[model samples]
Target: MQTVANFTPNSIVGEIEKVLDTYPYNPYQQAFSIPDIRQQLIEYVLVRIPCADSSCSVESSQENTNQVPVSKIPRTPLQHQLHLQNLIHQGICVIMQMKSELISQILCETVQPVCEPSHWFG
Candidate 1:
């Protein structure tokens, strides 16, 4: 087995070992081929996206700024909360509407042939 110090992050085996460390299960439980292990690990790990502010740098920015930068748009706590609530409400409404329409379509198809009066149901 290659030593950790000798391992480079570029190789799939090394990446798999790093990912395995994040989980509680024994890393050696199953024999893993480099490509499959790499693919699975990459799929599971979340990718970070940069914030919307064009001037913001992920590496240099502080966790929270005392004042918003000139390029960034600032919002009051209440405004931010309300914006989030509205977005969530709209998303839920869209999802529920789609689900209801799909269910209605399936019910219509299943009942169409069995109904004695298709024209009345339609």
Candidate 2:
């Protein structure tokens, strides 16, 4: 049984990287290829995880701040790993969903109207 101290942010990131590596690069349209997008996905998962330090807070301007207090629960290493895995999967799903919607919107905007059969024949 690993202690809470053992579950550092680096370990969490390593797990995320491992999962990301398992996914193929083609289907995402090179989304994972973009460093910023990949980092965003990692950050998404990291923000959701409870920080080990009670005083830990993200640095953001007052106008844009949306802070939420997270309650930490003690768990075994396996449970911690599982929780992170679940969060990683969810983050991937959200990214993919957004990508799909963006593609759909672009297609809708770019698609030309079809000509009638008579016009084609004429």
Best of the candidates, TM-score: 2
lDDT for each residue of candidate 2 in 23-52, tens digit (9 for 90 to 100): 775545356555766787777777777663
TM-score for each model = 0.26, 0.56
Worst 10 residues of 1 by lDDT: 1-10
lDDT of 1 by residue, 27-68 (tens): 221312235433433333211111322223222244456533
Cα deviation of 55, candidate 1, in Å? 12
Question: Which stretches of candidate 2 lie above 4 Å from their native place?
Answer: 1-6, 52-74, 101-122
Every candidate's lDDT: 0.35, 0.63
lDDT of 1: 0.35
Q: Report lDDT (Cα) of residue 72, candidate 2.
A: 47
